[model samples]
Target: MAFLPTTREEMLQQGYEQVDFVYVSGDAYVDHPSFGCAIITRVLQAYGYSCAILAQPDWHNDDEFTQFGEPRLGFLVSAGNIDSMVNHYSVNKRRRDKDYYSDEGVMGKRPDRPTIVYTQILKRLYPHKPVMIGGIEASLRRLSHYDYWDDKVRRSILMDSQADLLMYGMGENTIVEVADALASGLEAKDICYIRGTVWKTKSIEYVSDYIMLPSYEEVCKDKRTYAKSFHIQHENIDAIAAKVLVEPYDGWYVVQNQPPLPLTQEEMDFTYSLPYERTYHPKYKYIPAIEEVQFSIVSNRGCFGSCAFCAITHHQGRVISTRSKESIVEEAKRITEMPNFKGYIHDVGGPTANFSREACDKQREFGACKSRECLFPKPCNNLIVDHSRYLDILRAVRELPRVKKVFIRSGIRYDYLMYDKNDEFFDELVQHHISGQLKVAPEHISAEVLDKMGKPRKELYLKFVEKFKQKNEQFHKDQYIVPYLMSSHPGCDLNGAIELACYLKKIHHTPKQVQDFYPTPGTPATCMYYTGLDPKTMKPVYVARTHEEKAMQRALMQFTYPQNYDLVYKALKTAGRMDLVGNGPKCLIPYQKPGHFPSRRDQGKRYGQKPYAKKGNERKGMKKR
Candidate 1:
């Protein structure tokens, strides 16, 4: 149970302090104020919508958290960085399974029961109050999904979360739009006609047409692939236009990515013209709306990398867009003026922080192929890569003092960093901007996978790692690389897994943790996971999403004992990775008796397919298996 209560009555009973709409995520070096669920709560309160904002609402207890002060307005959800679609479940389960569907967090072991993160308490206390679900989690779940993590297709999230409605896409604009719509004498059923909304009604249901986006699965493998498929230059309308009927389950149609309307120079300038001190102190709150940790300004939107497993191209499209430096600087000044203001600016970056000017490889007179690598189908010849201007803005930020520190914590593209190795300012960024450790997504190590994903050569990753490792050593502090590794991307199979494990051994360091592949709501990889064939190449690849397969890929990343030993041993045996079994740098796979292994999971259990256990982990003296 959560330390906090899940019920509205429980919340009202307790004399809690003022409810906070936006709070900081408790991760170290992650001080940015979250903009999802909490942000909406703040906005609602300001408009006299009568809601409470609880920062980092305890997931363990929904009752207490929901009960606090004001009358209940529906709950809005967004997990940040990760779209709610994939973040709903544990990493491995959410990403790899095809048959996997999202639920409203776990209710009980009715066996195969569906649940959401905070539905129980909401159901228990506010049964009469409306609870609207939105953000990536609900948006992706609005329709049936082919979860790569589970290896089989699953039902839509709407059917599972049991919330009144769901609003998708970046909800900053949508949440206010939705709240205002609901507050104005509009019925929930009729609200479906609103753009970027999902709701239900009697007799007939309504769902606004989904902007044709690429498959979520493909983005998991490489965002560039998604970009190639749907971006304007490649503009493969047939693939994106191909309809996957929602009749089997009613809600919304499959993703349909429209042409990316690149923000014009004037529009970019206009965004810069908006008030940068983006703070919202609702009427219900006692304090100001701004937070100390996260004073953020989006420098640019969308990506030029067009990785196979990303959705930027499918959603925001390929052409990069930006806000002016003056607007961002002014916002920083406004934040500084707050009574509670501290000389701290957590982050000032966006989707691939390095690319300031839009278009990948922007310098060439003759354009590259016009395929959408980030989407699906294909990338275009007109792809451009431009990052020169972004570097200047970052330097300008460094000179600003009221802003104590500027962070590029939003997952940097090392490929961009490598292009201009001599850019001294970038090296400074590596030293100052990083919060002890820099996180870069070197998604995979295989050449084949890299090419398919439209990523730079694997050699480039090696070169950058070597260069950065040297730089970090020179810096003489704890600053190191927090590499993001993805298992079971579109082109990855046993070979890819083995290769990754071997690379870890060669690097002489083991990853403290890792993430498994998640096909998300709208990406190309989901289709490949479902059909076991990459749409682009029509190549057959074994989708390793079974509990055993997922475990095999995971074991190489850690030294967790017994629970992981069996899986690791099997993975090594299957991959012909016997050398890892003996006492070597990366050897965790030595043969051991079943119960002697060390892992968070029990013996014979694997992630995504852990067998039914009668008791919870907290239960004392209970036998595991």
Candidate 2:
């Protein structure tokens, strides 16, 4: 009688259609409607679920790496923009000029990204699907960590990326409870009973307790010896069973472990009030600067600045929850109704972005209270400070009417903006929101690797750069803030890089850039930048930790980019520091090697490098010397 339309009345009429769920990410970074994993896969397809992202995953393209539309069921993985626990550590050499320029990999096997061949080409083309994995480089390699640039003990990234599970931290309620338990069909060994997750069945290893970082190196050298070392408790122990060996010619098993239960500020403010729209509406669909650009809103997460070469104090737990400011002006009015709404709102402070909502008075008791971030892992507490409801939600989304200016552009804990009684939110963030230059990290000038990267006191970043150059010359406006400095971390040397080229030759200020310190995966200074030695002064230091000392610490963070100022002023006057340059001050950084600035002449034809070439060897600029 009804000539057509009857696949159960076309599935009883358009309601449940949650497709494949594929995700993937090796790292391309912010481009689609401006990414945060394409706004967390468009907040899991607006909570109905049918996601599909895939940035750098080619895995020898079998019809373009499987997942042919629907029935694929599972697979998330994610380098989540390189931090896959700092890509296993080479410290990407002295943190090489912003966003990891290279420690190992400028190119070579990208086949898309996050390799073990993106999990052996998604387990030889989805033989049974359900892969999972999470970000912050698979949650600091999910288990059995502590590499410190490979000094040892590493295995449990679900046993090196064979991955059938691993969600780890900051995954907003474990990604909507693993997409409502695989849309209620379950199985991948019953989604490993879910917690902060980590599973494996046909060989055994089901970890659930989740925090873990120091998996060795004498428990990453103490914290009551790594919480009585990676526990196997058994005492009042709720659940346990051991004797494992997943491979040494694959045989033994009996593993079953359960322990993780720490997330709560109402589960971190219900993962910062996830409805996560930040624009792209007409019923939704707009992630494209290639994916995302300057419209991220967090308000706060975890970061007590315990630098020990940061792993965000082993992934977001030094507790600091915050979200309120009327849920950040309704996520900045959903990033100003999208479709490229750039009234500038790139990032709104968190993880040390002015210690939001005062880190709920000491969450994980790291030697209990007595602030200034438990002493110089920096954020210097003149204590008691507040963002006055995050500067009244950045002055009510810059007085909205199509919001145009509101960038506290991320990293700015300049010792809590020189906290002399919270200097008027650091003088109204250097007179109304700085966009030109303010990045601040002060990783090291080396008070012995800022007390092993817990930082501060290298004479307090020159008294917060002479109180931010006398509050920008009392607003005479010469505005510039830039000091993210980190140089060869683990107790640095060359007397800590010539005492950081003699404190930029007595703070006249020469740093066009300098982050030289690489050791990424599971930090604590990647075991002192890959064991050049300094397990607390076991001597012998000056390690750039190779790759030619991180290319001379990436040509030593351009000591003032006037084309590497005469070879960074002849390597800071041959590491002698020429009595810190002159005249009233602010500009005297020459260790030579800055050559042809303007981003190496806009990376001259992308490294064929020909901006009026004649200097030879890739057009090496400046230096008539």
Candidate 3:
């Protein structure tokens, strides 16, 4: 169980003249199961294919890429675990200074779009070698979609990267099929019929029984057409029920086959049981990305809670897949034996912790519903709301020989928990799982905003909160719920933000951080961000696109902070909520004199200036930037 060869010397030491595949990635090599590059490379190795890794190769030239030389089969490329653009920029489109995926958390180690950059570089260097791109970046951009950073529609990445194929979704199964085909002497263009892949085709004369989406021209020209096209794509996400989808360009069509079938319990067990180093490569002293997942165990894959802002539904699909309880506990025992074992397992969950089985029995035979959601609007009657299996696994891990505590850090769907008639799992969760705080996403309290987010209504979250409080009290514990709040989602305006701020005031809860709606590609909310229409219904939606408005919405969430006083005051005044602006008990803030909202003392050093301390204390703490 050695790490994959990264240099030519290491490849030669392994007694190989040339590897079968050279996997390029934007992230530092962390051969943990949590990283997609690790999974794909390890799976290929299991199938008797020699592979080498080119982790975060310098994109300035082909010098670094030549380390692995050429492969016998082809090169598999991914933009790390996260999309490179999202990794490099903030929600405000500002270039972020820290990248967790790089050595020492440095930024600019990889270019903005590594899938495109790396593939284009490979094509120029190798010319005829097969190139395939996958990972969150390629999976989301496999179709023609909106580009938030560019502020325009972009064509499929397959067309731009000149890569022969783009594998969307979890690529364990898709990679094997494509790799086998390539090994059998099939060219990239000829390997078109595999599921969970998008490929370029000059003619669809042989294609049959596929839905032809609106051409790239139509979606770019008309917002309504774009909305309609996005909705059509959303409806066909399930593998069992979905048909082949084709998006037309001027000359060629980008065809997406149905998603790969969800993995079975046996397959899920085999995937996690593979030998992995479970840490970053020894070359680097430290990588910030490996801290959280070093001791974590992934119990499941895929999510059914189809939030509009999340791309999990698009990439992992809504179908839930789980590992057997024995498989999970076995991993926990191994974690206990690590040299740095701390008597604690950081996490025992995946996309959603409580989802340990299929959404319903029908989901296995048929697929998740095409027209409606399983939890949003309301829980489906057919929805199976049980957490017993997950509870059993948690109990088993806790009883392991050297493990002292097991915690669940990944999100738990509170709405789904609230819908269950049985409260045993809920009670035990409050007692055992949480580490003094349970984090959940309510997103927003406004009904309109929640609707646009495809989240449950506010009433459901409130009920869950009350139940959580009751459970904590019953166990004689002091626990709190750290609700994940977002601002300026597609349907949110000044009034919506104000409504959420008022709710926070009522509950005396101010979030430590608020997530501004980021419109990355391949999400229903992103489609709304670009077209100003809800892709689900094609109705007009209010979007806070202006910088001032988006700031106001964000500030309203943290209205208690002195730094946000000015923005919050303006938001309240513009919304004509003057009644709530006075010095009453229910007032958000005291009225300040006109043009003198926040004093210099109140502004403090938050505005990039040295604080003016009191005259006597000035000499006590005087530091210059």
591-619: candidate 2 lDDT, tens digit per residue: 22245345645544323334545645654
What's the TM for model 3? 0.95
RMSD of each: 12.3, 24.7, 6.5
Model 1, 326-402: lDDT tens per residue?
A: 76676566667767656666777777777676454442222223433422223334433345677667767767767
Q: Residues 1-625, candidate 3, lDDT per residue (tens digit)?
A: 8898888888899989999999999999999999999999999999988899999998996789887778999999999999888999999989999999999999988998999999999999998999999999999998889999999999999998999999999989889999999999999889989999999989999999999999999999999999999888988888898989999998999999999999999988988999998988899989999899999999998999999999998999899999999999999988898999899899999999889898999998999999889997898889999999999999999999998888999999998888889999998888888899999999999999999999999998898989899988899999999999999899999999999999999999898888999998878999999999988777899889899999999998888887888898889889988777767888887665344657665454333355666776453233542
The lDDT per prediction is 0.52, 0.54, 0.90
Candidate 2 lDDT at 58 equals 54
- The numbered model that scores best in lDDT is 3
CA shift of 23, model 3, Å: 0.2
What TM-score would each prediction reach against the true structure?
A: 0.61, 0.32, 0.95
* Model 1 weakest 10-residue run by lDDT: 22-31
User: Ten consecutive residues with minimal summed lDDT in candidate 3?
Assistant: 616-625
- Higher lDDT: candidate 2 or 3? 3
lDDT of 1 at 257: 24
